[model samples]
Target: MKTGLPFRRPRPLWFVALLTTFVLVLPAPAQTGQLAPGVRGLATRAPKNMKIDGDLAEFKDAFCTPVEYFSFDAKTLRNRAVQFFYLWDDEAFYAGLRTLDEAPANFADDNHLWEGDAVEWYFDTRQDENFRSQAWPTNANPGAVHCYWTGLKGTNIQGRFCLRPGYLNAIPKIMIEVGARRTRRGMEVEFKLPWANFPDFKPKLNEVIALDAELCYSDGGPRIFRTFAYGSPLSVQQPANLGKIQLVEKLAPSLWKACGPVITPVRCDTAWTQNSRPQITGYMAIPPNHAEQIGVIWRNGHVTGDLRSGVPARRRAVAERPGRARHVSFVRHCL
Candidate 1:
C-alpha cells in the first residue's frame, strides 16, 4: 500500500549555511578500516526515520563501507567513487549507495543492466553447508541471489534473480524498496531487502554473511568492465574472495553525528562523486536534533552561514542477536 506524504524540502537557509561552513572548515571525518580493500567491517542498525527517497540523509550513522580500491585487469586501479552504506532491523537488510558515473545512460528492461551502466549485487546465503564447495559457470548455485538497478529517461527499474532450484519456488517474495535519483554528479540508489526473502537464512547478531558490491559500467552496450568492493576477475566465479559483513545493533544518534555528512572524506568531482564530481550536496543538523531540529528551510544551494548549536544527545540500548550464516555471499548491484 502507498501513502501520500508532503515532500520535505532541504534544511533552512541559516542552518544549511552553518553546516556547509562546518563541513568545509572541519577536518575530514575519521573512518576506521584496514588500509586495504575487501576488509570485513560492521553494519549498524537502521536510523530512527529511515526513508527510501534516494537521498543520503536516511543513511546517517549506518555503517559506511567503502567500495573503492577495486582492481580491474589486475593492473589498473578501478578508481570510481562509490560507497555502500547499510543497516539492519528485525526484518530486513537496508542499503544506501552513491556511485560516480560521469555519463549515466542505459535503461534496459532485461538482465542487460549488467551490460549497461548499473549497480548490481551478489549474495550467497551460506544457508547450505556445501555452498563453499560449489564453483563455476555450471553452478547457478541455489545459494546465489543477484539484484540490480538502472535508469533511463527519468524511468528507474530494479530486478532480482536467484539460482535456487525452481526459479519461483526457491526465491521467496522479497520485500524490496528502491528509490533512484540522478544527482548533480552521478547517480544514487537506495534499497531494502527484507529478511523473509532469504528463507533459509535469518540474521542474528554477530554473524557473518558473505557479500560483494559492483559498480557495473557500459556506455550503452554489453558490460565492458566493472569494479568491486571484493571479488576480482575470477572472484565472481569464486565466492571465497567476497568480504564479510557483521550485523551490529543500531548505533547511537551521537555516533551518527560524529560521522558528519554522508559524503565524508571528500573526493575530487566536487559534486558528491559516486560516479563523478564532488561538492557539498546539502546540510544536515548535527547530533541531538538531526535535520529536523533546524528551524529555517532553504532551497538546495541558497543557504548562508548563521547557525545555532544547543541540541543535547540522547542514548539508547543495544538490541540482541546471536546467529549468522556460515558462508553467505552478499552482493549489491547498482547504476
Candidate 2:
C-alpha cells in the first residue's frame, strides 16, 4: 500500500551566520553514512497544531517504542512498562515517555537529579560517526548529549546536564521546552529540543539521528532501578549507542513509495585527528519495510555503508552486492 503526499521543506537557520557574527566555535556535525537496520525508528512531523502539554492525547495515533530492558535490581519491574513517543517539526525534535508506576517522584535537583525518579536521556545528533559511540563526552567535538528531566521538582519542570559540572559550560545554552502530567495510573513527560542548540545541524527531510529514553525509578528512597528503550550502558561510555530515528513527513501505515534518507556530512577532506584510520561516511534513510530489502543506490558525496553495534565501521561498493544492513544502536529529556 502506497500513497503520495506533499511535504514542506525544512527552513534553515543559516547557522553559518554564527561563525561570522560571534566567531563561535561549533562542533561539526559528525560525518554520516548509510546503514539500514541502524535506524531503529522514524519520527513523523508534528501536527501543525501540536501542543507540548505532556498529555498523550496528541500522540494517541502515533506508534510507540517500548522500554523493556531494566536493571538487575528492577527485574521484578516487568509490570512497570514504559512507552516512548517521538516527533519532529521544522524547528525541533520532540520526545514523550509514559510508564506505569505507583510512585513517580524526583527530589534531586540539578546535576543530582539522576538519583531521584527521573528519565535520564541521551541523544546523538551526529550520525554514523558518533551514532552509537562508546566514548565519554568531550568538549572539543562533542557528538552526544546527556541530560535528565524531572517534573517532580514540586515547583516546576526542570532539566539539567548529566555531563561533568563544567563540561558543557562552553557551549551555548540549550533551551528545551518540557512539561509533565501526573495521571492516576502514572505520569507522562514531554520535551521539545530545538535544532538551534545544535547550531551545526539543520533539520532536513529524512535527516536521521540516534537517541534513547531511559526511565529511572526512585519511589522515594533513591533511584532503585532503571530501564531503557534502546538499552545501552550510556552512564559514561555509550552516547552513540542510542537508537537511530529519522525525520519524516506524514507517517502512513503502509507506504511502499517514500522519501529516501538525506545523509549530509561536514566537509573535511583533511582532519587532524588523534586516532588513525578515521573514516568519512554518508547516511541515507529508507522505509522500515524496505530496510531489510535494500537495493544499492548512490547519493552525492555519500556511499551506503554498514554498521556494527551501531557504529559505521567499513565502506561498501558504489552499486554492487546485495546484503543486509546492520542496525544502529539507540534516549530522551523531560520535566
Candidate 3:
C-alpha cells in the first residue's frame, strides 16, 4: 500500500507546525485618522475665534451625532429630533444642540433645569482605571462631571448650567457663555465649558474622555420626552455608562472601522437645507502592490444607475502618493 511518497506521512508534522499563517491582535496606538475601538466619538479641535452665539455657522462642518434614542420617560415621541455637536480648544470645550421641536420652551432655573427642556451632559475626565465606573460619581468622585444646561426661561433668551450635585461646588460658579434661539424647524443652543472648570483635564490630541449629551423636552412641564448623543442605560445614574471621545485635530466625516481599504475625510453634508449640492471629497488609501489606477463610485440612495449601466457612478481619485491617494471630486447632488 506504499502508493504515495508523502500523502500519509504528515499528520504528526502538520500538528506540531501549524504556523503557515497567523495574525497578531495588537493594541492600537493613538491615530488621528483611524476610528479605534471603545472610542465612540471624536472631540475635534475648534477655531480659537469660534463665536459661541448659538449660531452654528462654522459648526456646520463639525462632527454631528444624531440624537435618536429616547429615554424611558418619553410618552409620545413624535416631531422630536436632535443632533449634538462637539468641539474643543485649549481654553474651553464647546457643545451645540440642534433640535426639531416646533414650540420650544424651558422655564426652569439652575438645579431644576432638568425639569424643563434642557441638556444633561455627563463627562468623565479620567483615563485611568476609574474611567467609566458604574457607580454614581458622588462628592467623593472628582473624576467626572454632570452638567445640566437650560436654554430659555420666561421672556429672556439665555442659557445656564448646574454642575453635578455636591460636586465641584468648592469651585466658583462655572461661567458658561450661552446663546440660544428658536429656529424654523426647532431650537438651537450653544454653550462653552471653559477648561477652568475641569482643571485637571487638558485638551490634547488623542486624549480620551467619556461623554454623553442628553436632551430633555418639557412641553411646559416636567420632562415629557428626551434623547441623547450616545445612549447608556445607566447614564442617568452614573458617569461610567457614558461613551468615550478622543481629541483630534480634525473630524472624521464617517465613523468607519479601523481595518479596510480605507477612504476618509470625506465631506458630504446636508447643511440641512442650506446647500442643495454638497461638495463630495474623499481620500482612499492605496494598498501596497495595488494597481496605479483605482476607481471610486459615488451613488446616493436617490441617485440611480450602477457600474454596469455607467450612467451615474462617478470615479474619484487623484495623483498617487507613497501610501494614499487624494480624492478628486465626486457627484455634486445630495439631499
Candidate 4:
C-alpha cells in the first residue's frame, strides 16, 4: 500500500525551512479588484481537522465553489467540473481543490509544469488602498506569496512556495505545509499558507485580502487551465487582478470539538541505519505518520540504519540521525 518513499530525495531546501511556525509580517494595504459576488471567503467555523490526503469526507461540511475552466472539447467543452474549498484559523488559511480529470498524467520535477498539468494559487497580501497607483507589483508590496503543488503522475508530489519577486519558477524558494493525494477520479490537492509568510499580512475580523486560484489539466500534452475568478484574471504578476478573501468570524472555541491530528515531536538516537525504516511502538493508538517520514532522511538519502528497538508506547521517533534521533507523535481523532 505504501508508495515507495514518496519520490526520491527530500524536497528543495527552500521548502524544508518553512516547516516551522510562521512569523507575522507587518500589514500594508494593497488594491483588490471588484470581488465576484460569489467569490468571498467561505466560512469555516471550527478549524476542521484535515490532511493533504485525497479524502473528501473532511470537506463534506466545507464550502464547495465551482471552477470557470475544465478541459478542451473545442465547441462543446463546458466547465471542467472543479471545486475549491476555503478554511482559515488563527494561524493559516487552507484551501483544497477536487479536480476531475479523465486522463491524468505528465508530471515534471521542476517548474516546467506548464508542459503538463499544474494548479496555481496567487495571493496579494498588501490589499493596498493605493494598489491602483502601481502598474504591477514591486518591492513596495513584497509580502505577496504565490504557491503551487503537483502530484507527478499521481505517484510523486511536492509544492513550490514563491516568496521572492517571481511567481512561476522551475524550483521553489521555500516550502510550507502542503499536501496532495491522487484520487480515482483525478487528484485532490490540499495546502496551507500561513499569514506569517506574508510581510504585510495582518489578521483581523472581516479582514479582506486578495486571493485567486486555478487548476490546469492535460491528458498527455497541451494545456487546459481553469480559474476561480472570471476569465482567469488573477496572476502572480498582477495583484490588482486577484479576487478578495474576507476573514469570517467564527463562533467561540467552546461551540465545537477540536478535531484533526495532534502532533508532538520526539527525539531518537542515530543507531538506525540509512534506508532502514524505524519501528515505532508503545502507544496503544498509533496515528498515521506523514509519507515524507522525518529524520535520517536527507538529499543524499543517508540514515544510520533500521530501528532495532521500539520507543516507549507514548514516545514516538521524530527523526533519525547518523548519531542522533528524534520522533514526532500524533493522535488521530484527538478531538
Best by TM-score: 3
What 10-residue stretch in candidate 2 is worst by lDDT? 261-270
lDDT of 2 by residue, 1-335 (tens): 42332222231223212111111221133112233455666676777666777776666434345443221234344225566677788787888777666667677767777787677777777655655667645674365577666666733444333443545642354667677887655677777777776766778877877776777787655788777766546544666566667676644422211212211111112223424343221122211112222222322222232322111121221111122222221211111
RMSDs, each prediction?
16.7, 17.4, 15.7, 20.5
Question: Top lDDT: which candidate number?
Answer: 3
lDDT of each structure? 0.48, 0.51, 0.55, 0.43
Cα error, candidate 2, residue 94 (Å): 0.7
Q: Rate residue 170 of model 2 by lDDT.
A: 25
Per-candidate clashes, comma-separated: 42, 22, 1, 31
Q: What tens digits encode model 1's per-residue C-alpha lDDT throughout 177-220?
A: 76777775566678777777766677887555666677776644
Regarding TM-score, does 1 or 4 come out ahead?
1
Residue pairs in clash, model 3: 132-240
**Could you give candidate 4's per-residue lDDT for residues 74-170 as a string of tens digits?**
2222224455666676667777666555565545545455445666666665656743222344443365655555555433555433333353331
TM, every model? 0.54, 0.58, 0.63, 0.52
The TM-score between candidate 1 and the true structure equals 0.54
Return the TM-score for candidate 3, rounded to 2 decimals: 0.63
Report how far residue 96 has shifted in candidate 4, in Å. 0.2
Give the candidates in order of TM-score, highest first.
3, 2, 1, 4
